[model samples]
Target: MEKRNIAISLPCTGEEEWQATREPLMSGWLTQGPKVAAFEKAFAERHQVPHALAVTSCTTGLHLALAGLGIGPGDEVIVPAFTWVATANVVLYCGATPVFIDVDPQTFNLDLEQVKAKVSDKTRAVIAVHLFGRCLDIDTLRAALPPSVAIVEDAACAAGASWKGRPAGSLGDVAAFSFHPRKSVTTGEGGMVTTANAELAEQMNQLRNHGASLSEEQRHHGPRPYLLPEFNLLGFNYRMTDLQGAVGLVQLAKLDGFIDEREQWAQYYCEQLSGIEWLRLPTVPEGGRHGWQAFVLYVDPAKAPMPRNEMMEILQAKGIATRPGTHAVHMLAYYRDRFDLKPDDFPAARDCNDHSMAIPLHNRMDAQDYAYVVEAIRQLG
Candidate 1:
């Protein structure tokens, strides 16, 4: 194995972040403080939503969202089988069953027909993930889903993505976003929950900070600054630190440029790989403005010269890194054994788990790196 020169994912942070983080560290007020409030305000304004509560991670944000929705035992939450397991795991945290459904074979998004088929009286919500930064069809979901069931957009990979000119965070009833290093904008490790409903937003706000009726900043800054806060309900300590908030401000400002650079690189990948008959490239649906978080491709094993895993191995040997797009949640041991699920139950999802490949697509890559990835894959023929 040679020394790898290209990375599959990288955070494109610069002096702005270093300079921003200095104040938070120096001030000695690192918990959710002024910086966190500023970040929340900026994020809410950017998404055109009334509320945005910063959290420790997207996983916690999803948990808080489901908890806020009052989804408990016996309720079912429909999840796409082809996403990161966290989307479904949160339902488990709420003591609810996660009903797995197949995604569209082409777009790799939630299949509305499958969703309609799965919804029942016990259905409480649906977790619509914007996988790889492409916005799922919210309009069709709005029209098809009954008012009794809620929609939670897992916009983990979608910061700049939009559908019909509306931002991803604002499209669904409530949304959760990630600012992990791999995301377009990063806070090292942080998440945000956005919603138009004041009641849900207030509940989640309390739920993230030990169920406090008043935050530390609120209590310390008000007229009765010495008073301790009240804990009204059960909550988790999922608050984002001021350090991350400071970095988030810098990253949020750079998000659009990051997306633009990623889109350009993605187009290059598409153009260079277009002639390869064995590759199935990603597609942007009619109204979807892709954020291009990651460039995922499907390798048809029957048509390709090698199998998907073999192709990944070959790429790895060439000093290029690649990964499966994501796992089929149902096929994982816990879900399979717990629910008595089989791999063939959701054919499209199983095929995706076996064949879908995520290659290098990030702001850190240059033309030379892109060329190497394309040439390496082309050689597989």
Candidate 2:
């Protein structure tokens, strides 16, 4: 294939995902049902969590995590300034303030010092994001936060990732995962929330189903078929359909293999691209096994032959796609205007905002594609 035809990411789904949807379609149990339960069970077990609730999307899953944790008005949630907007947005959804903190530019994860400085009596939670598939050091963050402050793992880009042998979803009090098309595994557009606490899980379960006291399965299997569930707390329709659940199961089953393949290519890219001094390659943390969702590179405009954006343009002309690691939420219009923020307010986030670049990294890419991307980047040097 030509360089221009190479995509940043292409879902590795095919006939298997199509076939998995057959049962859900034939039974007409398209809504959340047996398939969703099965997918949740498999996901929870894989992540070593006792409960995993399928939701509409990671954005909604994050909302559920905060709501289940009882985070609301007058509370604050710590968030790394360098992550996807959803991380900070979810806190606001709970009527809680998202206390933004600078990030460690190298890791693109939370700066623990900032976390310590920003946390307070009103701090109810910290949305620890494992940006770019590198799992966060949850143990250290837990030690840093007060016992009352919960850690919500924003594992949106970290499926199959781990820290010190503990999976990403199992490390935090509760974790939210994305199944967007770009992730290592996908259900087209869906998400799952995993937690070990039964009480919290029950609350999230109810909230995802419009705060129903009992599940649809409970009603369907009960003797009184006409009885409707009671509502205790207000909730949203965040349930994942059986069709999506079916695809999720198949995707979940293949997650390990997918991660392994990506990891290999990531290593190869690191080895091959290390020679370019002006380009900073990604590095997995000491105890973290990165899921390799996207292999993001940091371009130093001062030393590089061209500016970061110029290099991106040149690559685009070569048909190789690239994107920033993620946006700096504080720089976005809504947050900047609402908070009266400046670009330099968070220096590291601003630096990353202008320099971090994510090249093509996905399961669909073969050895030739990887080599082509590497050569194209090396040529830039």
Candidate 3:
């Protein structure tokens, strides 16, 4: 029989996405306009937040969130060492130092205990990442941090995920969410910042549109035709196009269905791979809901007869795609060289980076494909 190719991650798109695009194109007003505003409004309402500002990407959203908080030079922002570089890069973007903290081995999120030790008078905020679609225990983290320190969630991988019955984006003071192709829903390349704080939301709104109090489209139709909007702060052109917004609106509607399908696939993988001593399946904590972004398994090289790299190669030959769980931010070349850090500094993150591998868990997978993956792993044993 011919082998079937399995992708580690694939965006779910269909007629709805195409219809969304067509309508936006026919509207004529393409740049951040009614469509974008409606998307932001609907997103905010979905998350039960007061405001949402759509931007170019999650990275820019984080930057704007940090800027809105007035976190700049001489400040420190705690970030997980095991997440994407964007989490820490935003801190640097604001002229603040990113204080790296090791993640919990189980959840692959910032360790709450470690977060306490890292806090200081200079600590301005903590960028808590809901890694692999699992929400970090924000209540515990909030209890650990000083009252003055703001908590900004890097919920890039979490769309419909929740913690203790609360939505992911609403758990923190401000949160950034991604709409990248791999996410549960895609806007091609877009992001949104959610917050209940009115001032922060207003600031983020201005920051995303070149520091103008009113966006150009809003100003054009206003009575003050000759009045130029005031620029209160230095900002960036991080506006999301109307086309992306239209697609996102349609995608957001299907987010619950996508998450449900992904969870079902995850449960199937767990059932098939449970007895394999060499592999550690992903876990969801009590009272928490995971978005099931990527089904990651940790390969124990000692128990497994084959090495990690060898296993990856074998899987590739079998037409299965795999990827490393997020990078160890502290050990990345740029951060290591710039900060003079070593892998040993963050032991847990280092271990996670070395052993974790992500497998396919998209909505399209069926039982046969999953069984094939399990049998391949059994062969390795």
For every candidate, C-alpha RMSD to the true structure in Å: 1.4, 1.0, 1.1
TM-score of each: 0.98, 0.99, 0.98
Global lDDT of each model?
0.91, 0.93, 0.90
Candidate that would win on TM-score: 2
The C-alpha stretches of model 3 lying farther than 4 A from their native spots are none
- Model 2 TM-score, all chains together: 0.99
> What are the per-residue Cα lDDT tens digits for candidate 3 across 33-65?
888989999999888888999999999999999
lDDT of model 2, residue 357: 97
Error at 334, model 1, angstroms: 0.6
lDDT of each residue in 149-216, candidate 1, tens digit only: 89999999998799998998999889999999888899989999999999999999999999999998
Q: Pairs clashing in candidate 2?
A: 4-319
Alpha carbon deviation, residue 267, candidate 1 (Å): 0.6
Q: Of the candidates numbered 1 and 3, which has the greater lDDT value? A: 1
Model 2 lDDT at residue 162: 95
